[model samples]
Target chain A: MTRRATWRRRISRMLLRCLPQLMPADKVDWATAMTREFDYIADDSAALAWTCGCVLTATKMRIIAMVASFTNTPHKNAITSVAVLVVTALAVTLMVVAPRTLTPAGGGMAEGGHVAFWLMYFWPVIMLISYAATTRRGHCLPSGFLLLSLICLYVMQIGTALAVGPAMDALFHAFGANVQAWDTTLKLALLVPPLLTVLQWLALNRLDRTLTVRSMRNDSFAA
Target chain B: MTRQRKASAQTVTVLVELANNSGQWLHGYAISTATGLKSGTLYPVLMRLKESGYLESRWEASPPAGRPPRHLYRITAAGLRYLAATDDDQVSTSAATR
Candidate 1:
C-alpha cells in the first residue's frame, strides 16, 4: 500500500476506536454498528468518510443526551443554588485569606503571586454572574454551573498553591528537611487541579445521571 | 404516547424506504445509502421512529466471520399505519392544489 493510503487507514482505525467513547452509554450498540459498517467499505476515502460521519453523529448524540439528562427540576435548582452560594463564599474567603497569608507584612505580593491572587479573586465572581444570567434566561442547571464550579476549583487551587507551598517549605525546614518552594507550588497549581477537575466533572455527571433516573422513576409512578 | 407531529421530507423518504422492505430487517448503513441521508441524519430519525413505536430494531443474530454484528431495523405495524396516513395527507393536499 502507498504511504498515504497507509496513513489514511491508520487514522480511520484510530477514529473508529474513539467512536464508542464519544457515544452515550445507551448508544453503544449503534456505535458498534457504525464501526462494523466501516469494515464493509472497499475504498479508503469512503471508509474515512464513513468514520467521520459516525464520529459526528456520536458527538451530536452525546451532547443531546447530556442536555436531555439535565432537564430542570426543583431539586436540581435548589442544589445548584446552594452550590453557587458555597462557591461564592469560598471565593470571597480566598480573596480575603490569600493576601494576608501570602504577602510579607511590610510589603506586597510578588508579581506572579499578585496575578494569581487577583485571578483567584475575580474569575469565580464573573462566572457566578454569567451562571445567574444563563439561569435567569430559563435553562435547567445550565452547563454554566459546571463551568463556574471548574473556575472556582482552579481559584481554590491557586489559593492553595500560594498559601500552602511556603507553609510546607517552612515546616520542612524546621524539621531540617529541604524542599523547593517553586516546585511545590508548580505541582500544586498545575498538576493537581486538572486531575481534580476531571474527577469533579465525572462526579457531576454521575450525580446528574442519578437525579435524572430518580426523577424519571418518580414521573413514571405519578403517571 | 407519541405526539403527532409533521414528518419532514427526509423523514418521509426514510419511512417509504423502510416500508418498502416491511418484513426485512435493514441495518443503518444500508438505509442511509438508499435514502441519501448521512449517518448523522439517519440515526436520529431511526431513534425517533423506534421511540414512537413506528419501528423496531435488534442486533443481528449471526454475522460473517471477522465482522461485529450490526443493529437491524424493521418497520412495525404502526409504522405502516403512519406511512399510510402520510401518503393520504400528501394525496389530499395535492388534490386541493390541483
Candidate 2:
C-alpha cells in the first residue's frame, strides 16, 4: 500500500520472473558435497543427512530420478548419466532460445545485454563446481557458492548502472524517449541478474526439501 | 626430533577425547585444529552435543589469558555416562577379539 512497499513488490516480482529462466531445466542432486559412491553407508543417520539433498533445484530432482533408477537396477548408472547429459543439453537450448525473440533495443551500451550475458555465464559455473563437491559428502551444495554468485551479481549491477545510466540518459534525451523511461529500463536491467540468481537458489532449495521429505518417508518405511 | 604421525581418530575417539579432557575449558578453534577437522564438521557435532545437554560451553574470560573470548566446551554428567558406556563397549569388543 505504501510507496516503498509497492516498489519492493515490483522488484520482487521482477526477480522471481527471471529466476526460472536462469535455472538448469533438469533437477540437480541436492545431496553430496562432492560426487562419489552414492550407495548406502555404514551409519544410516549420518549417511542419510549427508546424502539427503536439503535444497531443491532441477539438479536435485535429476539426482533423485537417477538414484531411484539406480535402486531398480544398479547397472543403469551409465544410462542415467547419459540421460542427465541429454536433459542438460535440452535445458541449455531452451534457455537460450526461449526469450520469445524480444529484440533488445540498444540504447547506447545496452545494460540488459551485458547483465544477461554475465549472469548466464557465471551461474552455471557455480552450479557445476557445487555439483562436483557435494557428490560424496552427500551434503547440500555449499552456501558459499550461492553467496559468491550474489556478490558477483551485485558488482555487475553497480558497474552497469555507472556505465549505462549516463549513456542511456544521453541517448533518451537526443531521441524522443523520456528520461524516466530510460531510468526505469536501466534500473530493471541492472536488477535482473541478482534476481535470477536468488530465484535459482530458491528453486534449488525447494528441490532439496522435497528430496529430504521423500528420503525421510522411504527411511521410515524401511525401518 | 621426529614428528609423530597424527593419531587417526574416529568419531568415537573424538567423543572420547572430549570426555578425556572434561572439566578443562577447551577452545573451539584449538579443539578443531588439534583434531584436524573442518569447522563445519566440528561445529555441528558440538551443537548436537550441547543441544542434547551432553556438553556445556561458555565464552572464555580474558586477562592473563588475553585472548578473544572463545567458545569453551566440557562434557556434562550425562556425557560422562555416555563416555563410560562407550568405554564398556570398547572393552567388551577387545575382550571378544582376544
DockQ of 2: 0.03
Instruction: Name the regions of candidate 2 deviating beyond 4 angstroms.
Output: A1-223, B1-9, B33-41, B63-66, B87-98
Q: Write the per-residue lDDT of candidate 2 for residues A58-147, one digit (tens) a residue.
A: 234446554664566445443543343333333333223222112245533343434434544764675556444433222233334333
TM-score of every model?
0.60, 0.30
Best by TM-score: 1
TM-score of 2: 0.30
Per-residue lDDT over B12-56 for candidate 1, one digit per residue giving the tens place of the 0 to 100 score: 777878888989999888897887777777777887898889999
- Cα lDDT of model 1 by residue, A13-108, tens digit: 999899877787666667788888878777788678778888888999989886665554456554664455445444444344444445554577
True contacts kept of 1: 0.59
Candidate 1, lDDT over the whole model? 0.66
Residue pairs of candidate 1 with colliding backbone atoms: none
Q: How much is the lDDT of residue A28 in candidate 2?
A: 18
Clash tally, candidates in order: 0, 31
After superposition, candidate 1 runs with Cα above 4 Å error: A75-199, A206-223, B1-3, B88-98
Please state the CAPRI-style docking class of candidate 2: incorrect
Alpha-carbon RMSD of each model: 10.9, 19.6
